[model samples]
Target: MLRKITSLLLVGLLLVGLLAGCGAKPEEPQTEEPAKEEALKIAMVTDVGGVNDKSFNQSAWEGLQKAENELGVKPGYQESKQEADYSSNLELLTDAGNDLVWGIGFLMGSQVEQAAKDYPEQKFAIIDNYYENPSENLLGITFKEQEASFLVGYIAGKMTKTNKVGFIGGMDFAVIHRFDYGFKAGVKHANPDAEILSQYAGAFDKPAIGRSIAESMYAKDADIIFHAAGDTGNGMIEVAKEKGKYAIGVDKDQNPDAPENVITSAVKRVDNAIYNVAKDLKEGNFKGGTNITYGLAEGGVDIAPSSDKLVPKEILDEVAKLKEQIIAGEIKVPANKEEFEAMK
Candidate 1:
């Protein structure tokens, strides 16, 4: 009985030791699952000009595409066929739970306004428009269009052999007026003797009307024609090409399509603005309920040097000086007829 007791005690000690050894073994390393990435959803609604219009619509879409490739955003877009489609198009993106939606033109001011009021939970942005009292969720993006137009107008002033230049506008809206005013200022700055004439297409998408108006201007001895008529501007450019005269393109470079005719383009950098806004949202720094104006100083607007013929170095040097002056607040480009007259 004594031997059995001793053996039992020894066995119990061994079992306890084995149990402790088992318990002391380190647990299998547990890996924390990699944190899931947040979704990036950004969308844009095109004005009547569509994504390929190569104007504001195309410019805005380019920005969204850029954000998609560089920022890892899944971008969406809906093209509007007419003015009536703005709200529904905006709703399409918002209904799909997009993080942000953008409207490309000022023509949709009322539509976006109503939509913003109706969908307070959704964030919204509109280009080429300024709202006096925007909703907390709405962003008003207006460019210093005059600043950019001035540069191009100066170019036109220096390059016009006819000593006569023209401007064809779309819709005669405040935005178009701003462009016209800045362009006139630039032309006057460069060549005070140059004659300036302007007319409106009465529609943003009417190319035939633009061509007809441009034809009249050209016949009237206006050799250099600048257009801010969205899709209609394309027709104006075609007229310039047909006449073998010069055309200053808008929004984006038209040199790729008509290098021979397109002397230069007044670029709005809509793509950059749109992309930056999306980037801000992704970085958690989007500023809403404010009017953000990007001008020559901000690299938001300028004349594209995408032509077959190079600008004279003297002309370029002069333009650079003017640009510097504008940035330094030594110059203020006008946005209206009254303001332009005051500049004189």
Candidate 2:
């Protein structure tokens, strides 16, 4: 009997050991949360104006910064020193494995077209110009700058005590042409007799030329000047402040830079467009091979309201009413020289 009991005890101990080994959970299956997705990488190739022109390039950089802050993405940029640098800069970004690359101005349109073809798998976004034939990986963003410029021009026409307004452009491109024509149209719309003098600096980054051109306009009795030049616009604003005349800004709300002279700014919201494209790309909803246009209706263009000190309350109220009309389709703003001529 003692032998049998000892054997039973040994058998029970063996059974308990087996159960414990079997129920040990197999080390929790060494499970992991399925490695997190890697962050997206984006790059921007700035136009000849560089990054700090306080215009389109600056706005585009702001958008890239926004993406870095909100999307957990990495951002990089390369500045193009000249037209020849466009292709090489794009190649550098592509070689760096950038998931998306942006070309920041109309001057980059041709380079973007070629780059898009060279890298069919990589995505590209171009501002201010849309390719007639785009690849599946390319997105073209165009703005109705004239719509915003017209509003600012109307304000200039109403505010000018000298009955003379001037337009200073960075270059003689379609983008600047729209600004010039739109300003003239707005002047005419507000006061049929208002005279608008226009000139182009021939270069977007030359502040000296901008200042010289503005001085000429001011000499001719232009009390208000609208500048679409990049850094050149800064020079124009500087002259306006020194001359104690009103200056209209472009691209962003530049009133803070020259508060005493900047009555208002024709805001292009370039950063907003950049942010939208980046956001869409991150969400895997990027739509390419198409041109996208942003207008007052889409909140893509407008006049900055931060210059209340320079723009009187009456003018602001009137501008607000016109903004509503434009959005409601009750008013159609001219966008080009032809449309402006028709309005005249």
lDDT agreement of model 1 with the native: 0.90
**Residue 242, candidate 2: how far off, in angstroms?**
1.7
**TM-score computed on alpha carbons, candidate 1:** 0.90
Q: Give the per-residue lDDT digits (tens) of candidate 2, residues 1-70.
A: 9999999999999999999999886655556688888889999999888899899999999988998899
Q: Which 10 successive residues of model 2 have the least lDDT summed?
A: 25-34
TM-score of each: 0.90, 0.92
Residue pairs with colliding backbones in model 1 are none
Each model's number of backbone clashes? 0, 0
What is the clash count of model 2? 0
Give the residue spans of candidate 1 off by over 4 A. 1-32
